[model samples]
Structures are given as C-alpha cells and as structure tokens.
Target: MTTLPVRPVTDVPARPQPAAPRREHRLRSLDGLRLVAALMVAVYHYAGRGGEVARAWGTSPAEQFPTLHSYAAYGCLGVQVFFVISGFVICMSGWGRSLTSFFASRASRLLPAYWAAVVLVTAVFALPVVAYEAVSPSDALLNLTMLQMPLGVDRVLGVCWTLWAEVRFYALFALCVVLPGVNRRRVILFCAGWTLAAALTRSVHEPLLDLVLMPEYAPFFIGGVGLHLLHRDRRDGYGWGIVAVSFLIGQHYAVRDLWNAADPHAFAHRTSGGIVLVVAFAFVAVGAIALGLLNGVNWRWLTTAGALTYPFYLVHEHLGWPAIQLLHRTWGLPSYATLPLTVAAMLILARLVHGWVEKPLTPRLRGVLNKAR
Candidate 1:
C-alpha cells in the first residue's frame, strides 16, 4: 500500500565529473497488484471460510456463495503474494536510504493507519453493535506499539499478525543488508544466506532462529529481493537462482500450510496440488512485474486503488465480519447483497483512513522521527 520511493541506480558507470542521481522507474503496476492481493484476502475472509459467518448466520457461506467459495478459498495465498511484493519494494526503496531514514520511512508508512485501525476496531468490539469479542484497554495499548505478538498479548485485529511478520522482515533486512548499505553483492548474499537458513529451519531446535528466520514465509521475501535485483539490473544470474530456489522452498511451505491449516474445516477440501499451483502463480506474477512485463499498464486510477490497500487489509476481517453479521442477519439482507455492500463500505472506510489518518500522519510522523534523529 505504501509504495517505497523509486530506488537509485546501483550500476552507474564511473565518471570524472559527478553524475546526477537517476531513480528507478516507479512500478505503478505493483501498486495495482497490491490492491488485487488485498481484495483476494478480503474475499477469502468474507466468503471462502464458512466458519465465522456460519456461526453468525446459522448457515454456511460456502453454501451461500456456492460458485465463489471454492475459488475464494485460495485467496489466503494473497499474503505470500504480498511478501514477494514487499521483498522487491523494500529492497528497491531501501537501496540508497540511510538506516535511520529507513526506520523513519517504515514507521511513517505503517503506524498512522495502523494506530487508527487499532482504536477503531477496539471501539467497535467494545460496543454491543456486534457479538464479536471485545479487546481490553491493556491489549489495545500493547497493540498500539505493534509489538503485541512478541509481548504475548492478543492482537486488537487478528489481521495484525502479518504486520508482525513484516516487522521481523524489516528488522532482519535492516540488520543484515540496509545497515551495511545495500548493493548487488550484499543483497544477493543476504538472499542466499536467508534461503539457506530458512531451508535448515526445520532441522534446527532453536526457537529464536526459527522465529527470526520465519522459514515458512522466508522464501517469498527472499524471492522478492531476488526479483528486485533482476529489476534493478536485468543480467543477474544469481538473482534468477535466488528466485528459483526461494519459490521451491516457498511452495513447500504453502502446501504444508494447506495440509496443516489451523482451521482444518476451512481448508479441508483444498488440495496440496492446488496450493502449490497457486503459490507458483504468485511467484510468477511478481517475477513478471519485476522484469517489467507489465510496464505498459500505466492506468492512473490504480494509484488511488493502491493507496487504499493497507487500511483495506487492516479493517476488512474483524470489522467487515460484524458488518456482514449486522446486514445479513439483523437487516435480513441476503448474502449476495450483503457481501458486496460490506466490501464497498469497508473500501470507503479504508479510503477515509488513508486520507484522514495515513496521509496526514505519515508526514508528521516522519518529521518527528527525523527531528528526533
């Protein structure tokens, strides 16, 4: 949702006179892809899984949206798609930035809408508008810090779990690559080392290693970095190798998640082969974007659509469910009508959060952070 600034050229030729900086082209297509990924996740939560809505409506959503439910089940893979995009975007944006500036950029980009959503969701849960679980004040406070997962506290919004994973990726990236200064060699090594560490995670007993390595999600991010390398410089053999290996490792984890899904009822009917295929598609899609295959897609409206993606993802699950419950059950609206209405309302809410919360706060937060620095 927060597209990092275009990256600086890493392969500029030497000249006696100082050369002007040439920023990489902004991949607006990636922004459009982000919105698609967000929508996929949203659809998955609302229609794919029958559990949450089934409890509220006394009927299965799968049965309600018979045609859409099967396809929607695979929408959960949108997270992996996001990670791949993140790897490419983060690496691109972080290339020429300072560590302090990087932190400031990330904090500014993430926190405002996140803080607003935490409070909004907390307030929603506190009210009797829906039968959803209420988040306590303490949990709300911890969530504001965005460190609730490691703090052993519950998330204010269940979707914030991905934020934690992203945070870990940022920390690891900053420490290993950004802090040391981003370059072709260091980035390649970072991806390579990360791939190896993730591969070995299943054989290791160290909790911290597994936690930091995030073996299940590592390949997507690693593959993303590899993709960025290709984007930055097309003749990167090591980058291609990294992408290939990461996809292989990432596919294994994706299939594993399908089989060992926490909510077996939601994914029980899904096949490992389907999961593998979907994950492979995500990688391929991202790879195509990185290689500039979609350069011709410069639809200006996608910029606005992309801007709403982050907040859309944040509020869609916890908040949308209640809206669905209220509309379908309380107002006697049918699933056909309720699903689209809820999604539209959530998108509008996301736009509001983006405009009122994120746009206004990001600059101020960045200024404050920069001043502190």
Candidate 2:
C-alpha cells in the first residue's frame, strides 16, 4: 500500500473577488442627438409642405416656404431616428433591471408629461382654438391610457401614434428579453426574432400582430439593440452584422413607403437616393456613438436638451399649430418668423414641463410603482 501523507489545511479564508466597475450609463452626445431628432420633427411639422397640416399660412405651404420645405420634407424621417435611439436607450437602460423595474422606469418617464399634454391639448381643442378636429371626451380618456390607437379611438394628438409604437416595443422587449433576464444572447435572439416576426407579419392581415410587431419601424429598433450590444461589449462583429442587416431592410422599407408607392405622402417625394442617404446617416450616427466615437462628448447642456425632448415632442404639434395659426393668420407674422417663434415658445414650454411635471412627478410615480411591486 502506498503511504498517503496527510495534508494539513490552512486556517486562512479565501479572498473575495473584486466587483466589476459599472459602466457609465449616460451618453451626453446622444442627448444632443435626441434634441436634434425632436427639432427635426418639429421642423417637419411646422415647415414641411409649408405647414400644410395646419393650413395656418392661408396659402400652399409648399409654395409659401419653398426653400425651407425642400429640406424639411425629409424631417419626418426623424421618427426613424427616434425609433433607433429608443432601441439603444431602452436596451441600455433595461439591462440588469427586473421586469417590474423596467415597467416602472418607462411608465414614470413617459406618463407624467403625457398626461399633462393630453389634458392641455384637449382643453385647447375644446375651446375655439385653431380649428383642428376636437378630440371627444371618450377619446381623451382612452388617450390617457395611451391605448387609443389599438382601441380604435382617434388620437388626441397625431404624434400619440409614436407613443403607442414605443409602448408596443416596450411590451415585446419586456416579455421576451427583460422578463427572462437581459443578456447579450437574449438580446440578439430578440432582435433576430422580432425582425423575422415583423417580416412575416407584413403580409398577414392581422391587425393585432401588425400593431404589436410594428413592421414598418421594427428594423430601426432592432438595429438600436444590436448597436447597444456593440457599445457594451466593445466592437462585436455579430452586432455589426445585425446593424447592417437592419439598415438594409429598413432602407428598403423607407424607400418603398416614403418614396416609391405605399401611400406616398406628397412631401415625401425626395429622391430615393436622398432618403437612403439620410437613413444611412442615421444608422451610422448611432453606430458611431455605440462604438465610443462620441465618448468624449461630455457637454452638460446636452443633458438639459435631452430632458426637454420628450415634452417638446409631445406638446409641439398640437399646441404649436394653434400658435402658428394665430401668429400667421391673425398677427401677420411671416412664415419664417412664425415657425422659429413657435418652436422657441414650444421649447420654453417643454423646459417648464420638464421642470414642473417630469422632474417632480417621475420620482414620485416611480416610488409608487416600486411599492406596489
């Protein structure tokens, strides 16, 4: 028998492993980009086709502001930029949080200002304000839930449709990825799965599925998720692949819907090449930020600008249209003057909402949600 030497164990305990440093979540440049996107939409709504939506200029907007309209015509594509940023921001924020936490965060962020805007717009419309279609009381109540669109109620504000889109994205992301716990693999799967579902559902006449998948806007959001992966892991080939594929699919849809033949809006008649270029630039911009190209962008003002974007976007159109109508039709301001002034006023109001509503309400709402959970 081989002699077995008895080994003596030491009394020392094992050392604790060091925790990883948390990545800083804030991207100041992206805040600036958010402001840019909000401003783009504002410009498009106010000046695109010469304020045709409001018809406040008393003449054809396309003809009244031909120079400005030429460029602002593509500003509607800012919505695509917004969806892409939402993807990146949502994934970045949702990572490592519980599903309840995610829900609370989104609700807190979206609802306070949304509620205020709904009330404000409804009240303004109820009065003899600018002659836009008045939202009914029942519709206003549904709008408060942000479920007006799916419930077959008219939107209190046309821009509310985008909020519904965002809510759907959040729902899908929460259930599929966040509920199970967010990880690189899960996010990749979510992106791929959503893309496929969106594609398949495009031809299927299922209203519910179409609403959930949002086929027209899915690529931008998916690409944002992929880009966030790259941001987190540092230069991932798989992430780049996802972004590339998303761009291709998204580009095709953008051209088809906005330019080629699918209910082509009169203002969306830009050269297909131009639309492709703008969409390409949007992807490249977000991708660059993800890859840390914008890391050194530490401008503090971008923070304030970013905070104002949501309320600015929320209140801009419905409120500003009336302002535009009054200033142009009643006060005799020129289109150029009226547009800028209206935007300035909206921005000021956004700052106020950010300060009075969002800043105060978000934390309280979040606290309530946390306790309920």
Candidate 3:
C-alpha cells in the first residue's frame, strides 16, 4: 500500500458544551396571589355561614371599597387561578417525561393525601357526636376514583368536587403529552375547541353530562395552558401589567355582581363576564413571562402559608359554619367579631394541618410510589 503523506497531529481544544437552560425560579408573586386567593375563599365561606364579621361587613357601606367584598365574593375565582397554575406547572414538570412515570408521580402526589382526607371526613360525618348525613358506599367509591363529577353522585367530601375536575384535566393533559406524533398546536386547538363546544352545549337539560364535564370551568383550565405556552419564551414587564389589569377587571365584574342592586339575571351576566376577564388575564400572564417577572422570590413565610392553602380550603368550610353557630349561641357576638375570629382560627388550623399532616405525608407517599414503580 502506498503510504499517504503523514498528516500533522493538530492539538485542537474540545468545544465547550452549552449549559442547560435553568428553570425560571419560582415566582413569589404567584404564591402571594395564592395566599390572597385562599384567604378570599375562606372569607367567602365564612361569610356565607353568617359569621358576624361577614354580616357586618356586608351591611357596611365600606363593602364597596373595591377590595373588600370584591375579593370575598370572587374567592371562588381562586380555584380557577389554581387550575391555570396547575396546568402550567404540571406541564412544565412532566414534559419530556414518560407518560407512565408522569401518571405514577401524579397519582402518588395526589391520591394518598386525598384518600386520607376523604376517610377522615367520612369518619367525621359518621361519628355519633357529629351525626352528619352519611354518604353511600357508591358515592364514597366514586370519590375514591375521583369520578364523582361524572357519576352524578353528590360528592362524599363536597370540597372534593373540584379535585375530581382536576383529575380529569390531568388525565387529558397526560394523554396529549404521551401520544406519538402529537402536535403541540393541535393539542392547544383541541382543548380550545372542546371548551367552546362545551360552552355552546351547556344549555342542554341533561344534568349528568353537565356535572361530569364541568363545561363551565373547562375554559379556565384550557386558557391557563394556553397562557403557559405564551409565556414560555417571553418575559416582559408589560405582561405583568396586563395580568394586573385583567385581574382588576375580573374583580370589578365579580364585585358588581356581589353588591350590585340589579336583577338576578343582570348579576348572572356580570358574573359570566369573568370568563372574558380571565382570558385577558392569561395575556397578562404571558407578558409577565416576557418581562422576567416570574423569577422566584425568597419569601419563606409566604411560601409556608401558601403551602397550607389546600388543607385550609378543605377544613375552612366545614369548621366555619359550626364555629359561627357556636359563637352565635354562646357569646352573641356581632357578625364582624365572630367572622374575623373564625377566619383567624381557620387559618391557624390550616397552618397546623399543613405542617403536621400534609407536609409529612406528601414526601413519604411519593417515596412509596417511586419504590412501587
């Protein structure tokens, strides 16, 4: 073989690899938003139960303060905010992962705590001292499967109705993520189309499908996912401003319904206005991403408080009515005093439950599930 001319061995430096893009830090503003939302829900429940403060506050001319009853009446809107955040974060976390692993992880994260809560509530309702109405075995089983929404059965734990909706949303989202050759644009379009169809068909008289699909709320979750994609590549301050304005507008409509001296139909129209407001809010959320406003804040205290919100949401409604009734019977306190006191107690208990129960159990359950898998 003819020897090829000897090539010189060049000392070439290896090219440096690009660093992985770091996840945007957790935004404290979102936690703050959560804290406010959870508090609003607690306050709303407390008000509905005829707590002294709620009554007094409602009667007071100060109720129109734009921040007072506005926040209180729209507390349920917090659940919508939660759906949006959940869709965003879950998609972010589970993206690029195997569908099996994702489902397993989600099940571990949610099922154990949820099951425990249901069992405890069932026990409470069944106890001789409580003498609350007992849920049927079928209903309990449905709740266990997170299928109460579609089954047309009353929820075993009333607060858990939303949880079932969340389960459905999660399942649908996972399927979209896992299926082969799925286009992201198509997934978004499908969610949007489904939501629109649900909205259009909502006037149908059948009660069963309405309860199961929860068409009224589907758009909120779908909008949230859309917002996530919009914000993924941009972080401009103007986005935050847009979110602020949308929130304000939504609050305006909510307050108008709560305090307006209009016909009930008028109130319904105003309340329905929030759907559009929330869509606007999504645009703002996208802007927030563009502005880099999503950077994580170091508010350990607020974060800690935020962590307790879920359990607080569950217990507040149950405890609030009884607490108000007891105070009314024993001390004859005014609505204002009893309301604030009851809310304070509920918040305190929520913190305790979060620290003592949910926090401790979440990690252990996750571990067990991981091992099982």
For residue 196, model 3's alpha carbon misses the true position, in angstroms, by: 5.4
For each candidate in the order shown, give its overall lDDT on alpha carbons: 0.87, 0.86, 0.58
- Global CA lDDT of candidate 1, please? 0.87
TM-score (all chains, Cα) for each model: 0.92, 0.92, 0.70
RMSD of 2: 3.4
Tens digits of per-residue lDDT for model 1, 61-172: 7777888888888889999999999999899889888788889999999999999999999888888756878777888898999999888998888788889999999999
Q: How many residue pairs in model 1 have overlapping backbones? A: 0
Span of 10 residues, lowest total lDDT, candidate 1 = 259-268
lDDT of 2 by residue, 155-205 (tens): 887798889889989999999999998888899999999999999997887
What lDDT score is found at residue 280 in candidate 3?
52
In angstroms, the error of model 3 at 272 is 6.2
Clashing pairs for model 2 are 50-61
As a whole number from 0 to 100, the lDDT of residue 271 in candidate 2 is: 72
Model 3 lDDT tens row, 220-288: 555555545556644433323333433443344444434433654321122545444544554455335
Off by over 4 Å in 2: 1-21, 50-54, 203-205, 260-268
